[model samples]
Every structure is written in structure tokens, then in C-alpha cells.
Target: MKKLTNFTILSLFFFSGIMSSCKKDILETIPNDRVSSAIYWRTESDAIYGVNSVYSALDAVNLFVLDGVSDIGHTNTTFTVEFNIENGTYDASHSRIQTEWQNGFRGIFLANDVLANIDKITTTNTALLDRLKAETRVLRAYYYLKLTGLYGDVPLITNPITAAEGLSIARTSQADVYEFISTELAAASSALPASYPTAEKGRITKGAALALKARAHLWSGDFAQAAEAAKAVIDLNVYGLVDEYGKLFTYAMENSKEVVFDKQFLAGTLTHNSFAYMGPYSQRNSSSNFVPTKALADLYTMKNGKEITDPDAGFDPMQPYLNRDPRMRYTMYLDGDPLPSGILFKPVPGQGGADEVGKTQYNTSTGYSLKKYVVAEDLQTPGASGLNFILLRYAEVLLTYAEAKIELNQLDASVYDAINAIRTRPDVGLPELQAGLSQDELRKIVRRERTIELAFEGWRLFDIRRWKIGEQVMRGPVYGITYFENGNPVTIEVPSVTRVFDPAKHYIWPVPQKETALNPALGQNPGW
Candidate 1:
């Protein structure tokens, strides 16, 4: 909560590699090629610039925060790329994750510098300085959360040190790392304003800080703390699940009550920085690589309010998406629905590009592709959407609270309220919580709702990890239904390892070999 006085955040920005891409209009004429404290953090404008640099770093887009943890990397269940037996030439696994492990650490290191140096600024207004510090802390906490989740344990560096000092530091245990994350967020939550004024409405708020704390604790398996943190956020009552489910994803409906923290994307200034930016709307829509699987799609319970895993799980898998969670409709563009911007999709005759030979490939198998994060109103825009990516939201908090409550085995009145709030959303029409259900049963229900509600907001990666259900869920020959020209479905197969990983090693990714080599001080996780 202390104000950054003599310390200039802009100095830290220059020292750390200048990698900001958030709001383009607010530019300071700081020479990017040079590193000078006198020239950099001298003006109040410089401080704001520094803060945006931090936001840009923390924001999910410009930096790929959870590249390793998400489905695209390892920990995927049911979708794997098979090794080419004939190719003695090339071998690939999730090595990109290990190679790029520094991205998370780089963000953390920059945040640490900003946080440490903010107090040194002498002429800055006390209130403005504190706000910048708090925002940096929240963003730092986010980077740390991603780090801890992926590696389980990582070096916890609060104060910035020289490269030599950093190299000698060993990794901290996950427990300790999360403790620091919680502590930092708690401080940030208290320091940040209850709400930023209209001009800064989108900035991190006390609620956003607390909401993030709640989720951080939830992911670390600290259920009691998670519940308490979640309670603190709910007490704020500033946010709620959007009345309509689809509104959460579209650009027109950004920064709603449901949105707690998100990466803001605009039409012109900033590129559509989410996974959607890569989505190909037409024939060559190959960039929608970030696809949801059948496991995710099937996890959503039928509107009749029955889970797919239920005794009467009588719904058809062939017509797999029918009567499932309404979120499926909002999230992915399936075979029957019209494409975004009013493009009607006809079934491609074959995998070959004969119909539209050179068009883009939005290869949505079984006629499904991602619609989330694509800006709808920007239909006339020159290129893709500018939808801001939300980092934290009340809906995820609600579910986190529900899951924490269930995990603690105290499904009392408070628990029911949180669960029911989401369950009875206009799209998800399920019966109210039943009495006398076991804790595990409630946990199952919580998990089901998470898959349906928070599917592609980058929640599932941590969700699967926290539940420790990777072994059960991520293994075996995963399958997806690819629709043919006649609307008939053909089963396309993915390799076993792609979908599954060895359970023990799967929960934690291999520590970057480069990191371990450089820092003999660090200890590797069990398997890797």
C-alpha cells in the first residue's frame, strides 16, 4: 500500500525489456533503444507508461502466460499429435513450453522491479503512486500464479536482483510460492481503491485483487483460504454473472459486472490479442487450433438437467452436442449454426480444399469452431476483432467459491447459494441443489459446471490440475466426430500421449532444463 515516491516505474520498464502492447494512444517519447533513469521516469506520464508496460506484460495476450499449462501444450487429454515413425529426422513433444518457460519468469521479474522501485519516486502524487504499485502487484501475482501452477514450485523473487543473483537462486516450494502470491494480493487488494474512477474504470480494483486472491488460493489447494478470499470478494458484490451466458465473450459486452479482470482489445489501435485473433473465419480457418474437445463439450449437462455421466445419460453422442450445456452453442460454432458476421457454413465435402481451394481453414471438426473472444460488432472492421481478454471474472469466482466449499465438505446454505446462482443461469437450467448429497457428488457437479461455464477462458488448465483428475481424464485414445459432406460423422483419432500423460509427471510440467542448467541452486520436480 506504500506509495512509490522516488522510484520510477518507467526505469524498471526500460531495464526490463520494453514489451508493452495494451493501449497504444498513451505513448511517451522514451527512447526504446536507450536505458536512462533521468530520461525515462522523470514525468508523471512516464509513470503511467510504466504501469501500462506492466499491464501489457501481465495481460494474457502480449505475453503467453500459461502456454505450458493450457490444452495447447501438455496436460491435454484425448488429443495428441502422433509421432511420425518414418521421420528419424524430427522429434517434437511439448518442448516449446520448456524452451519458452522464461516468458512467465520475465513478466514476474519485471513486476518485481517495478514494485521494488516504485517507492523511490519522490515527486509523484501519493495516491497515484499507490494505485500504480497496487496494479503492478496484482499483475505480478498473476504471473506468479501462472508460474506456480505450471511448475508447482518456482523461485519466489519479491525484490529485484542482478542477473548473477537470480541465477544462483533455487526454486521455492509451491506452498511457499502460493503463500507469497496470497500475501502480495492481500496487500494489493487493501492498497487498491474500492473502485477506480470513471476514467480508470477498467483498471484493477480491490474486488479484482480479492477475486484473484480467491482463485490463487483455490488453485493452490488452500480451500479454507480460498473460501475466505472468495467470501471477501462476494462481500464486495460489485460483479455478478451476466444474465445471458453469451455476453461474456462478445466485444460489444465487455467490462460488464461479470468481468473482473481482462485484457482490453480495441478495433484499430490494438490487434485482437486473444486466441481468437488467430481464428480463420473462412476456408483456411486453421488458427482456431485452440479448440475444445468432446470431453469438454460432453461434460455440460443436458437442459433436462441431467449430467452426461448420469445413469440415464441417454443423450446421443453421435448428435453429441444436442441438449447439452447452452454454453456449447455460445462457445463453439457447430455444424448447424451460422458463422460469425453472418457467414453460413456448409459442410466441407472433404478434408481437401476443393470447394474453396485456397481459402483459410477454420477446421472445426464435427462442424464446430470457436466463437468466443471474436468481436461481433466489428463485422465491418478491416481485420479481426479487438475484444479485450478478461483475466478474472465474478462467474469464475463464484465457481471457485462453490468448488472450495464443496472441497471443504461444508455444503451448507452459503454453498447452495453460490452453486445455484450459476446453475440457474438462463442458459443452464438445472434443478436446485438436492439435499443429502455427498461431498464428492457436489464436487462432480462443481466440475461439470466449470467445464460448461468457464471452458475456454483459460480456466480448464488449472481446473484439471487442481482436481488432480488428469490421469483419469487426460489418458487414452481421445476421439472427435468430424462431419462429412452428407452431415454424417466420421471418427478422427488422435494419439494416446497427446490426450494423456503419465499421471505422476502430468500434474507438474518438467522444469525448464535451461533453467536448471543455469541455476544449479534449483531443484527439479519429481519426474522431470
Candidate 2:
């Protein structure tokens, strides 16, 4: 698949999956030292460089077809005004989703070009032959999954077809997309290594393909199938939760048991380590993009406390975060001494204040900001710590199994044990589940556990969608306090969630304006 082509990177977008092309992207990123797509793939060395180019696309920005944007989702979670949808302040032309959409398709096309061309060329190194192809397929599948999930009914392109074919294709149903991913992942699982070589340890693995299948089935609501797929990796027994929940993402990255797949980042280099960028905007720091919302904050259950959702607990939802789930503290940036970052991010403990612009601002009105993915200790220009962005972890598979079993109404002692194993982690703050609880009770517990366990790993958006509550919860009140120092409490009312997600449209991003303006054959998503 090292063959360069006549097409640009976007040609890979619809290719086979999301990452259709690989080599062209590298040439473009390296500046004017241009390599025409039509000339390349000279030897094994060429293949190695070509594959490395493919790996280059897995950065924070490109990954946003899945992770929420740098500014909005990050800031929106905090109810911070980094990007405002209410004021029609959306930079639709430059949204990360748009970038993701374009990048994903570009990748798909590139993957197709490489995969199709590799077989045509002759190479004697049979050892690395299957390795490169296997990883490419895995990557293609990964990008397609991202695109399909974001914009339901995306065009399912399996090969690098001509411009005539590309321009006229219609959106395929999500069911078909899921089927494609399921099948591709299954095939790649066999071809891929259970783990990568030492130099290749960071690349795709058999475990990753299997885990992807598990997640795909989970999202598709194939609980029984999802459980079966997830159990395969769970049974492999190679992965388990990290001893400390907070250490899953670290400079050296200690927690690997559950991290099946991740985008590795090396600090002190020209790499994409955005812990500083995405984290809270503290006086001690710069800015916190994604904050934990009151709605999500409330997901944390209280310790030895009665249930608020229940009728007789005298539950005051106002004090939701207090005495609630331990995951709350780990997942959110709360008002405290030394937070998850451990750098003493006490932005507004007792004193409320204004910014340099003289407008009042507050640290998470719900007393919560994102702390999960923020690498707190590393703050030096090479300033932040090195950390890999975990794509899939064992904790998710465990929970997926538990949740699926619960849904199947066949949950047993093992299910509870699996869940408690995670709950028991010191990094995670919650206690064990109530013994012998009904399936319904188990359901509530799992939901709460997932909120704190996987809070900021880019799961909330999908969780809300799969749970089918995106409209209600995402459109509800994003609670916050705008404390100003006039000795008067300056409460800033956050606009409702309604502004962000339009029920009819706004699910998948609108096709990039340029694409539509050029291709008359292309149709926009329903709401667009």
C-alpha cells in the first residue's frame, strides 16, 4: 500500500473505511519537498515510511471525528464561552468535525489506494508484508467507524473508485456501516498480532480489532453479540484496570491492562500533547476546555447516602456532587486543594473574580471541570508530560459485558464481580454495588459507574446518543455560576443545550461547504 497516487489525501476519505490514503499525507505535511502520488513505493524502506505516514494522522485534531473539539466540547462541558453555538458563533467553516470529516475520508481513500497497490508490487520481505496490510486495514476500519458513528448513513466506500463513483454515491444506512465494520474487524483480528512488536507495540493489535468489534456491537445495540465479543478480550486476561484509576494516562503511561488501543504522544518534542490545552483555565494554568456538567456531575452517586432519583431519599439534586460518586473527583475538576492534576488548581474556592477583560468568570459553577485526560504534573515548554491518548481500554470491555448482561437479564455473580473489580480501584472513588440488586438497579449503577470511570475519554457524546437521551440531557440546563467580585454574586445563565444539537440536523456535520459546492451529485445530511 506504499504506492503513491494521482489523487490527493481527501481521496482516501471514502476509501474502504476512514483512512483511505497514507503516503500523500506525509509528503504534504513535510512542506515543499513534494512527492507526486503517482511515483513512490520503491522498496521495503518505502513501505515503512509510507506506513509511518499513515500513523501520523492519529493526532488530537484528526481524532476529533470522535473526541469532541478542542474548544467547544471542552468549553461546553465547563459552560465556558470558548465557542458559542447560541450566539450563532459557530465557526462552521472551520469546526473540527469538518476537519475530522475531511480527514477521515482522506484516510479512507489513502488506505484503499495503498491496499490496492501493495498486492500489485513485488516485495521479498514476507515477514513485514502481512504486518503492514493488517495495520492498514485496522486503521481504515477505525476511521470508518468514527465517520459512521458521527454522521449516520455515511457513504460506505470499500475501494478507491473513480471520481464518477465517488461523486454520485448516496448515504448508506448505519446498519450497513456497522455490518462493514463488524466484518472488517473480524478479518483483521485474525491477521493482526495479539500485540505489536517492541518497536510496533504502539500500533494496532489483535486485541484492538476485537475490542473495536465489541464497541461496534455495543453501539449497534447488539448486546448479546457485544457481550460475546467483549468477553473474548476479557478472557484473554492480558488486560485489567490499572491499580490507580488516575494513572491510566501518565507520562510513561503505566496503565496498559485496559488500554487496548491508544494514540501515543511523546512529550518535549513537536508532538500533540494537549493536556495543557484541554485542561481547566486556572489562574495557576491557562484554560480548562471541557468541564463536567451538573447533569453529568449528578451522575455520581452518594456514599451511604439515599438516592435522589428515588422518591423517599429527600434527595436535593442541587447538592448532587456532594457525597456522591468518587469518580466525580477523578473525572471532574472540583473546588479542592490538590486536584487530579495535583498542582493545587483552586481557581475559585472562596473568592470569585473577573478576568483581564473585566468580565466575570467562575470555575465550574457545578464545582466541576475536566481532570481525567489532563496531565497535571507536566508543565515545564516541552512543558507538559508525555502521554498516549487511550483509544480502547479493558475497563470499557468489562463494563460493556456487565451492561450487556444486565440488558439480557442474565447477569450473574460474575457480572457483579467484573464491575466491582473496577469499582474497587482506589483511583476510582465509588464503593461496591449493592449486593443482589435487580437488573434495573444494576442498570442505574452501571450508568453512574461509566460516567465517572470513562468521563472524559471522549465517551459522553456517544453514550448520550446510544442511550438515546442526547436531546433531553444535552439540551438541558448547563449549570454554572459567574461569580464577580463586586461583593455581589454574578450568576451567568448558560444557554440551554437546545442550541448545540438541532433535533433534525446537527448530528453528523454538514458536508464541508466546498465538497457540496463542487459536487452536485452529493446530498447533505437530513437537517443540513
Candidate 3:
């Protein structure tokens, strides 16, 4: 990723000028102090800053914490909007819901500003100009993807429009919105470079555009397009899975070859507090958040490539954490795991330790802390790590290809090779899938592999939604490891917050009431 410089400073000004908390229709006007199109979009540097400012809208907190809204996890804080969301108490009026709507459009507006004005800049470097334009278009498509994924249909504001004009635009059908995104991404993929130099790293590449196209097609159930798009990314050969899964999340691996697109961060200038959010209670200066439920913990397979419930797997409940997949220890903060403090993470009751889990102040309810993105050395500093939030990576491309093949009922040698590449990764060292499975069998395997591989990286919510299984897994008791009694792990079942996923309404968020009131043309979603 590029270092902090004029881009960071100018992005702050851009955000201050355009960001608003009111309804999307009337509150999206650009402030007078902001860089207006008339005078500001005349130079290459101006064009550069315009696109960089749009990247500021990508927040790690919102993107990464989305998994908690699914079955596998929950936000640590109670009585909050996220908690309400997990428990199915959220409505159109939730502040976070409104923020999602506002932020998604805010990014879109900024990208539109760049696209509308960049063409006016006098640049002899046509290649750079095309790349910049392609990058902006891909970002706009990404924001639209987020919007349509959360809200079934949304207002498709493609150009820079006045706030007054926006008030009269009605919602576009989700099919149309997705079609627009697909078209934009396809154009972007052609113009973008296959990769970028280190100095210009973290910019969108052709592979990222293709990967997103595959994601859109996959979610829309267009298996053929998804498979073809994913294959295009694979053919690029510019990216591959990192040698080790754990290294992919470290500061050393920022902008690594595996990352197609990421939210870049600099230590002193543009750092986020995700480590603090993912840390244990004692490690945190205040409240700890983002604990994993047992549902997630149990998804890891045995080292021998067998599920714990399989009778042939030699499962033992007394020593449940032992002999599990190597990825589990790297991904989760389990009891008896080594800590940076030269002690093990002992979450047993009355352990009098930082890792203790229970009803105490700042304690974890699920008896687990996220270790995937947490830097062990940064535990003392809490919110000081500059780890980048990886939005798209090569691993996802592989999984998308494998799943698309399975869905197409073309399960062949290529499908096995893709899934095995991840499973038998040098760091993982797990056994591969056996040969010659039926389409139905491989479909289950591929989905489970995605669950275990991408556990807390915030892809689970969309996966369940797209799979149409929200009611089955999301609406139930959220279980967690409680305490070890007589050397056996006891699972805690909390009845206070059983989730309820109403298939009728919970599949997509409702348009905020404030927006609907300000613009009567904007209608509410079903069962709001």
C-alpha cells in the first residue's frame, strides 16, 4: 500500500465536506468548502486525490464486524444495535442500519465526483488516466455491491446529481442494480493493470475487478458467469495463496501478492482499532468485542480431515481442542493457547486471568477472542497495530471457482485441485478431499470449507444469505465454550439472546424511515 502523504490529508477534507448523518436524499449535497468540480478537477494530482478520498469510506469496523450478525459470532457489547441485530430486534430506524445506508451512498457520491471531473484534467499519460478511471469505477461498483447485498434494491445514482434531484428518484430493482455493477466491473477489468508496483500497491487490479464480478454472479445464482469470471482471475497468475495462512493477516504481509484489494493502513497516520476490538478483555483498555461462538469453533475439522462428529474420527470431548486443524489455533484464542505474556490463555472459571470468560465486566461471553487479525505483540499497545483490512484475496477466488463448478454440476479434477490447494497448504497440512464425489456431496464440502477457511473475515453473513439458510443457522441458541469441569469442556447455552431470522423480512435491511419520509418516492422494503 502507498504510504501516508497528501492523500490522507486530502481525504479527511473530502470526508468532512461530503459526509452527513441525515437522510440520504437531501443530505448528500457537497459542502461549499469542498473541492467543487469547476475549479478543483484540473490536474493529475487533483484527480489522484479525488480517487484516494473515496477509499476513506471503507471502514474495517463495519466490514469485519458483519460476521457477528450471523450465527457464528456476536458483538461483545449488549444493548446495542448490533446486539439487537443478532437477536432480530433491529428495524429500519437502527442507527447502524442508517449508517450503512449513509456510508454506502457517501462512497458512491465521492466516486461519482471523481469520474465526473477526472476527464477534464489535461493528462498526456493516457495509461495512468485510464487506470485511475478504472479504479474509481470499480470502487463505485464495490459500494453498490455492498448496498444491494444488504438492501435488496436501492436507488442507482450513477452520476453526480443534486440532493434535490435525488429526492425524486425511486428504487431500482436489485436485478437491475446487479446488472449495472456487473457491467461496470467488466469494463473496469479490461482497463485496470494486472498488478501494480510496490509504491502504487493496494489499488484495484484487473483480478480484483474479475473477482468481484464472480462474486456478483455467484450471489445472483448465475453459475456460468461466476465460473468464467473466477477462471479469468486464476488465469492472470498474478496472485496466489500466501505460503502460510497466519502470515496473510500480519503487518509484514500488508499488500502481499495474495491481496487483490485491501483497506490500507499506516502506523502513525491511518491506523484502525481492530486489534482492540478483537482482543481479550484484559488486553483491551476498555471493552472487548468480537468473540467467536462455539458454532464457529466446532466447524474446524480434525487434522486427519475428519469431522469431530464422524464416528471414524476418534473424537474425544474431554480433549476437544487437541488434534484439530492447524488453522484453528491460528484463527482463535482458545484456552491453553500460548499468549504473548508468557502464559497460556486459561479461560477456566476462577482462573483470575485476562482471558477469563463469564458475566464479569469486560469479560467475553463466548469464552473466545479473535486471533486471526490480532497481533500478539500489539496486545500491550491495544489499538496501535496498522494491519490492513483485506477485502478481497486470492483464496476467495479459488473458493469461488470451486463452488461455482460444484453448482454447475461439472465437478471434475480442477475442482479437487482448487479445494486441495487450500487444505494442503504448507501451513495447513490437512488431508485433501477423496476422489470422485457426487455434486451434492462436493457442494456440502465446498461450503464447509468456506466456513472454516473464511471464519471471522466477515464473509459468513452474505454466504448464509445467498445460500438462503438464514432461518436454519442464524435463528437459534448461540452456544459457546463455558468452563472446563473434570477436564471436559462444558458448552454454555444462553437463552437470553436466541436469534430469530424472519425469512420474510430479515433477508434484507429496510430502507431507513428518514429517507422514505424525506422522499415519498423512496418506498420501504417488505415487512419493515
Candidate 4:
């Protein structure tokens, strides 16, 4: 996939004529290195570059570090955005809230800019032009999806707007925003190809549009529409799960067939610090800011697909890591587990272990570090991992289909097949769920499957909110691992931190304070 270079982004910003200056002389001056819209949109290359700039927003850390705010993941640092959100201490003035809002609108503005100017190019290839427009629409819908998902009702801006117009725009209802997203995706799906050439691998596709549509509907509680859209992607027969569950996150599997859509990154150019934030201190010599909580580890069922709380599950507190779901190891590094860098992860306090808690400020606070998406080579240099983050994959689509069916009380064979496909993947191979289960039973099973299958992929926060389980799961003392101390097993609660979630307001984040301040017409969320 071709990413937008820094220079290209600057060029696009200049061509859009969106940058403002306080001084009239500065506003009138043009840099020799920048091109105006009149000359920039005269070629086919310009159209492609303009659309590519929109993909840059997809790489925002706010999108990927979302699990830190949920019960499953914990953010250690007190100053970071995830910390504020996780602790319920964040307000409308939070930097991340503002950055997320601005980034989402920036993506929308870039996509709208391309849509408004792509026709200016003198291209004989009408098919390419249509595909580009479809791609831009998909990206625009994606931004709106993130915005409305986080802020409830956000302004739905589909066209490039002047500063004066942006100042007074009121918030659109979430329902209407989703309706527009669905309409755009439905139209884009038809114009997009099922697959792109290798050189254009990460470009948005028909499956991406349909899969996003399914997610949008699922989030909005439109089970039937969500199921229909997810099934459309499945029926396309263009995607399947990769053989190795763990390898799917590695750089080696960047081109996996399971990926419906992903954000592309180059090692030295556009990259993220995910490895440094999630890897063991011994592996990266950096603080593990985001680590898996004990609650997440306990969510995985035993090898027989029974919850540990079940009497027949044969779970031992002392031997918790043994006889559990294979994904538990694949997703996180437990005590005594060997890391990719060939270091034993022994986070026992006062044991002099490299990852031991309180050994150093850089050690894992949760006594466990994330194993998924941590490339050993990337550990050599923090924030330089080129591994593409899978935004939407086949597993999510399958699980979404199952959950939608379960929600609609349509417990059929296809639901079982969809869930079983992921459970029976060659590397996972957990026991297949039995048929003829009640809708409620299937719902529980599918929810658990989605949680374990997609852990740390930034969906848990939204899942809890949409399922209305925020009050049940979000408040409590967060815990870490169970380790033996002088022959006695002990579970450690993360110290000096309290978790709180008010069902009334925590379900949806507040609109950015700066935004509401600038445009009072954009009212605040109910409890914010």
C-alpha cells in the first residue's frame, strides 16, 4: 500500500486552501514549494494523492489505544489520555478528546476536498475516477463512524467548509449520522472492487465498505441491518481466517487474507509506538504504558471451552496459566511465559526479574505485557514498527454476524457455523459450540468469543457501551496477576488507581470543549 508522504500531505493541505493566517499579508503570500488547487487538480496523480491523504488520520493512537479505557486493559501512566479516560477523570477539555475530534474532522475534510476536486482532473479513465470517489466516500463515512461512535451526535460535514461555516454548525443526531454512513457505504460497495492489485493492496474495497456498514448498524442496535450487511461481506467469499492465530498480527502476515481493511505504515516514515507501550520492559527497555488486566486474562475459557468459574472447568488458582484458551498466551505474556526476544517474563515483585513490578518505572504495572502486535525487531527502535494495524478483519465480520443474529432471536445454523469457524481455526481449535442453544445462551457465547478473539484491538470500550454493560463491568478495583508468594497464591490489585464509570455520562465521551466553546450551537452531551 502506498502511504501519503509528509510532503504530499503538506501539498494537499495547501491545495485545499484551508490553512488560515492572522496577518493579511501572510494569507496573501504563497510558498513557491506549494501548489494551488487550480494547478494541483489538473492531473490524475493529483486526484490519487489527494485521496491518499485521508488515510493518514486512520493512524491516530486514540483509535488504537481505546482498550486502555475498558476493563480489559490498563494504562499505567497518569498523564496520558488513556489514563484520564480509564479513571473517568477526563473532561471536555482533555487533549485526546480534542485531538480525536479534530482528527476525525480532518479526515472528513481531506476526503471531501478530494471529492470536490477529483472531477477537475482531465482523466479518460472514468472507472478509476469512480473508484477513487467511492474510496473517498468510504473514508469519509469511516470518520463519521468514529466521531458519532465516540461523541454521540457530531456535526455531519460532507463537504469542505469555510471557517465561518464551521463556527456555527450544530451537532447532527447520531441516528441521522449513522443513516448517512449507511447510505454512503451502500453506494460505495457497488463501485468498489472486491480486491485490488498487490501494489494497491490496502486500498478500501467492497468488503471494507460492507464490513464498516455492518459495524455501524451493529453499534446502532439495528441487528437485522447489521446481520444483512455482514452476511453480504461473508457471501462475497473473498476473505478467510489465517492459519496461525498469533502470526496474524506479525509483520510477516501483513498481507493476510483475513484483513478486510488496515492502516498502512512505513518503518521509518509513518509508524506507531504500540510495541513500546505494550511490550515487556526486557524486550523494549521502555515503560509498558498499556498492559492487559487480570480481568481480561480470566475472561478466556478453559481448553474445554468452559469458564474458569464453572465447577467442571478444572481450573486451579496456582496453575492459572495452564489448560486455558490458547489465545490467552497468544494475546498476552503471562508469568514465566517466554517473550519473542527470548526473555522469560517473570514479573514477580522483589525477584529481580526484568519485568518485575516496582523493579523500575519501566516495568509492567499489570505484571503482564501484551504479546499480540509486538514485533521483536520493532523493540530495537521504539515507535518504528511498520506492522499494519488490522482495522476490520474477517473474524470481526463473522462474530458481528453471529451477534446480530443472536440479538434478533434468529438462532440458526449459520450463527453456529460463523462462531465455529473462528473457534476451529487450525491454530485455535477450541471445542466447537454445540447447536440448538437458546438465543440468550448463544448471545453469551458469541459475546465471549468476540471479547477473547478481538482482545486489545480497540473494540471492548464500544462493546460495553453498546451492550449497556458499562455499569456492571466498568467500576471496581482493577487487578493484575495471581502469583505464588511463599507457597501462597496472591492476586495483586493495581495500586493508587481507582476505576469509575457513571452509566449516565461515561457511556459517551463529551464533545471537545474547544469545539463547544467555539460553536455553542454544538451542545454538550447529556451528562457532560
Candidate achieving the largest TM-score: 4
Q: Give the per-residue lDDT of model 2 (tens digit) for 1-528.
A: 111211112222322232323465644442233443444555675565555445555545233223333112324432433345332244435455466678788778767766766664468776576777877787888888877777677778878788777677777788999998888888878877776545555677788888889888888899988889889988776787877775666654533666788765555432453555555555345344444544555555565434556566555444434665566666655554464434554444354422111123433433445655565455443235456677788889888888888889987887898788887776554567667899888998787677667766766566766786655655534554334455555433454443355556644556656666666556677756
The true-versus-predicted C-alpha distance at residue 357 of model 4, in Å, is 1.5
In model 1, the runs with Cα more than 4 Å from the true position are: 1-35, 59-95, 273-286, 309-320, 346-362, 365-367, 377-384, 482-490, 494-498
Query: Rank by TM-score, descending?
Result: 4, 3, 1, 2
Candidate 1: tens digits of C-alpha lDDT, residues 430-494:
66886777898888888877766766666676777887776676555444445444556555443
Candidate 3 per-residue C-alpha lDDT over 430-464 given as tens digits, one digit per residue, 9 for 90 to 100 = 99888889998899889988987888887788899
Q: Candidate 3, 438: how far from true, in Å?
A: 1.0
In candidate 4, the residue pairs with backbone N, CA or C atoms under 3 Å apart (3 or more residues apart, or in different chains) clash, namely none
In order, candidate lDDTs are: 0.64, 0.61, 0.81, 0.84
Q: What is the lDDT of residue 198 in candidate 1?
A: 47
For model 2, what is the error of residue 69's alpha carbon versus the real structure, in angstroms, after optimal superposition? Answer: 8.3
For candidate 2, the per-residue lDDT at 25 reads 62
Model 4 agreement with the true structure over 389-476: per-residue lDDT tens digits: 8889999999999999999998889999999999988888789988879988998898889988998887888899899998888887
